[model samples]
Target: MEEIEETPEEHLAKQHRKEKKDMQAKIQSMKNAIPKNDKKRRKQMTEEIAKIEADLNNKHEEELSQLKSSTDTKVEEVLNGVETMKMEGGKEAEAEAAEEEEEEEEEEEATQPRVTKAQKRRDKKATQEKERESRIAEAEVLNLQGVRHQEGLKLAQKLATKQLQIKEISSDGHCMYRAIEDQLAQRTKPEITMSMKELRSRTAEFMRGHADDFLPFLTNSNTGDMYTTDEFEKYCSDVEHTAAWGGQLELRALTQVLLLPMEVIQADSPPIKIGEEFDSEPVTLIYMRHAYGLGEHYNSVEQLKDPANAEDS
Candidate 1:
């Protein structure tokens, strides 16, 4: 007002009191809003009020000391008591508001879905099963590829054999083989008798020479070969020869023999001598040749089979 202005101290005191009143009202509102079930919220509210009161009391220390130092003990006591009461009021309000907030949170939690222990376990098992299945399928695919490759080898052999022709006698070189005309040899006399013992002996000698390829066909009990029955079947499986190149199994066998590790075969194999003879009959010869090895493919199969000459073989 133009008539009079309040002193600085008075203006400050008035502002402080108004601020104190607002704080008290806020605390009271907080208390009223506090729910009955929230003790934690109540405690927090009380702590907050205490903090505010401590701040206010620290700021008003000068006025409080002056009043106490003056000759007014009774007045100081009364004023201090009143200040304590105001601080308590603010604290009570805050406590109530915190309690209400805590209660609302509890209610929300109660409304959410709950999972049982059994359901959680079942879900975990299902996930594990799916992972296991994926692993099994991957393993199966690898196994299938191996089987397919073996089948392809067998098919190639069967095709080559069917289409193979016996060419006329060429130079007796071990590496040379050719396709020749399919001419039937004159039928042998029925009276001509061949010794089974001789054929067996010859076949056994021949097999010993070229043991690498034949070993896979024979059962392990017969000769310590490692191929399983299924593996053997896959290797020996028949194939339909196509007309493109006139497939013959003999050609396939010859190719395989060429690639065989010399160390695993007889060393002294006689040079392949397919004389002009039977074109219709398939002659399965087992040459007495040395196994091709790091240094020797000229040793005889009989020499290799001998235990005494094992080292040299």
Candidate 2:
């Protein structure tokens, strides 16, 4: 009740998202490395991509389906968890009334721990928390499994319509950092691209020095408390030294440290435009929801075809 922890269903989702991203990234890398003239290898790469797409999508779908079913059979599950705590407390009161005279129930209430209102309230909160967790799991399963394969096509369609194509980044946990690296290479030209490690370190350092800006927005998932100074340090250390996933928090830090705007293009939503104060061209990255095995993924954006070298390919 004090803190929300990852349930088994969530753990399964986390595993599958990582697997999906790794497989897709691996295939994309292989495809990118093949020479243009190697039509045969290109065909092979295409085939492999198709094969893994089907396999990973099916695997993730089946696993989530099974997990969802296991949770849904109970009325307490996310989708049907509409029952109120008051109703649950009423049921307990009804049961107590059936077993004892009103005066006896009152006596028990006065002396017995099990029939006390405090105990009942605690139980209600516990059930409420479980239902909340189930709701979170349901969303994750839907995002990572039910619509996994279609995400890429939808993204591609959006990109093609917009005359943009993916500049694939690896599926590793450092995806956000790598995506920024790729974007920087395009914007700065002959300037050397910064390493993902360096970018992460810089972002972490920025976050630490400007704690006031970010800490208010972050809370301890386990304790449901605002991060203390020590916990924020630990988070910063992990950002710098660990393969912790980066989100808008790190993105905010990166925008400040690098002094540039960044655009997050998603398949289904309008681009999540960040850093409006700067006049620089925004480095663009695509955000995936249901597509990548990683469950969520980011890739650099580029012109679908280079106009200057249109006929070269």
Candidate 2 Cα errors over 4 Å, as ranges: 1-146, 188-192, 306-313
lDDT of 2 by residue, 220-268 (tens): 6556789899888888988898767688899989888887888888767
* TM-score (all chains, Cα) for each model: 0.20, 0.51
Off by more than 4 A, model 1: 62-313
TM match of model 1 to true structure: 0.20
Instruction: For each candidate in the order shown, give its overall lDDT on alpha carbons.
Output: 0.41, 0.76
lDDT (tens digit, per residue) of candidate 1 on 149-188: 3433343333233332122222112111211211112113
